[model samples]
Target: DWVTETIVNNGEQYHGLNGDILVWNPVTKRRHELTSMGIRVTKKTLKIQLKMSGQEDFLNLPYHQALLNDEIPLSIGGGIGQSRTYMYLLRTAHLGEVSVTVWPKILKDICAQKNIKVLE
Candidate 1:
């Protein structure tokens, strides 16, 4: 509820899935993503996002089906942490160069746009 509210209220482009804000890296003197966080998806938002990314097939999966069936709460959950931060500090081209995690699609997308790759 609040998550969607904040997203719409902010009126930023592509923020439904990419909600993080960037800070200037004083040492490197470039934009840096210190955090990746935002509201979790509701069923409505989930469908919208899945379609937008052309992964509509995810809807057929059990977890997604449960949400669409209202077997789960309308509210859902955010994250930023050391793994990718280390990649940034090391000035590496890829996060996989430093760490590994299952990773979130939105986060991966943000890093990819920055020319950073993570472990699959």
Candidate 2:
């Protein structure tokens, strides 16, 4: 499904999950961060990340507190971009081909110059 492997650091802190990768379409030179799935962080790592990001105050929040107290089960989760997947599967050259979201005229023009059609 036009997937590729890539290494990412601090995924747990940045993505709030582990093992984030880029989804690429080499043929179209298009890419989208389709999903990030990975193991949940332990309390120790979460604390460290919070401190590093100056978000240590988050530890007091119910969700963060639960994580710190190990009240939440360790698990993996992620989000997938449905439109990106549909574009790839349909061999559409641009995201606009599969999505109805408004795009700037300049961007649409640029894509058109590249022979990438955008569905209206």
Candidate 3:
């Protein structure tokens, strides 16, 4: 899938859920996804997302209405660290101290044990 719009928990932007995990290596000059996430749309989520997109006519349909009425099981899905492009590029061991780094004891312990270096 290419450039598919995704939304999460009434989020503003659709983080890539039903899509591929892309990895772009600037040093190696390559882009790839380690794995692909399958269809992750539930009836409840779909209706909300469609409504947000201003396409609520889908709500009138039986399948769509069933979702809104909570007649179907919610689709359990989401992206796995799909939004961590920068940390991957920098080759950092942890994400706690990069954009808004707040170090926890476990992270500190792991960094110490693994000899992982983080530059502030």
Candidate 4:
């Protein structure tokens, strides 16, 4: 709600778009970047980001056009996935020990048919 609040308080359409939240891992006794994410940009913020990054031309793209026209929803999305996530969560002996995401359903069926525990 800070974005909304920032608008209400200052009449500015900007949101701080840069920082990230990190996690501390006790096992390694170090901080780790679990994911990267952002509050969906306001039209103004999007313009600023694009301009600053020398990608202002992206504004002409359909996705940006839709956003500026308020046709699509504001979104928040990011994730930590695959081998690294599995490695930390399950403490697998090696990268191959865990499936990062879903395998194809066909693969799952084949593994099942072979009595192999490959999908997890």
Candidate 5:
């Protein structure tokens, strides 16, 4: 995960954390993304989360107050794929063992040539 401290202060944090499985079929040349989601946090929920995370210092701050009152929308996300599970099971390079994405061209080419199957 990546983050910028100032972004959090300005209440402009961009959360890109999410879990999703990508399925690619070489023969069909098709790709699919499957996501499992839960209820997103509301502003009030954020306050609760902040408190839960021991960040209550933000209680009186505008951003913090907004969250406490449920003024902002709720959001939920996380990343997909377990590193060790894929690596051990597929006996492949780290990412290829799981349903990860953005495969390097070289890796893609090698996988294609070897007829390595991807399981989503």
Candidate 6:
């Protein structure tokens, strides 16, 4: 996890200590952005970010109004890609190798030609 900070767009904000993770695979020479997470923003900072982004109209929305009124608690949140994590841990070259999901026929055929088994 890298310590980072970012201004929120669409009424989201990070109060402090925000970061994202970029996982690298040496064999495939690929990097995947795995997650983005951070602390919730304060009303003051929310207003500032909205003004900066020229999105103050968001304040009219119910969710934004609640945030500005301190109806929501400050908290930390993030997203993670489950299949990507599985690929990294299992050292798989392709996402289909780690998780089962629908794939384009062309993609499946290409992987097949490459002698890559895609688990559907």
- TM-score versus the correct structure, for each prediction: 0.42, 0.45, 0.33, 0.45, 0.28, 0.48
Which pairs, if any, clash in model 2?
A: none
Off by over 4 Å in 2: 1-15, 19-24, 30-32, 37-80
Worst 10 residues of 4 by lDDT: 1-10
Residue-level lDDT of model 3, residues 15-120, one tens digit each, is 3445567776554455644446655566555755686778878789887777668787555332324324555656654544344555677767887787765444
Estimate, for each residue in 1-120, the C-alpha lDDT of model 2 and write its tens digit: 011234356543223444455777765886665555554566777777688778889989998877667787644332236676776678777778887777899989999899887877
The TM-score of candidate 5 is: 0.28
| Backbone Cα, N, C clashes tallied per candidate | 1, 0, 1, 0, 5, 0
Between 4 and 6, whose TM-score is larger? 6
- The residue-by-residue lDDT of candidate 1 on 1-120, one tens digit each, is 122323355675333344575766554567777556656677778887787778999999998998889898755431244654775777765546577678889988888787776777
- The per-residue C-alpha lDDT of model 1 at residue 22 equals 74
Top-down TM-score ranking = 6, 4, 2, 1, 3, 5
Please name the candidate that would achieve the greatest TM-score relative to the true structure: 6
Q: Candidate 1 vs. truth: CA RMSD?
A: 8.0
Model 6, 1-120: lDDT tens digits are 111344567777444564557888864788875555544567777777787778989989998887767787644342236667777788877888877789999999999998888988
Query: Between candidates 3 and 4, which one is better according to TM-score?
Result: 4
- The residue-level lDDT of candidate 5 at 85 comes to 38
For candidate 3, the lDDT comes to 0.58
Instruction: State the lDDT of candidate 4 residue by residue for 78-104, as single tens digits.
Output: 434444465567643333345545677
Q: What lDDT does each candidate get?
A: 0.67, 0.67, 0.58, 0.60, 0.53, 0.71
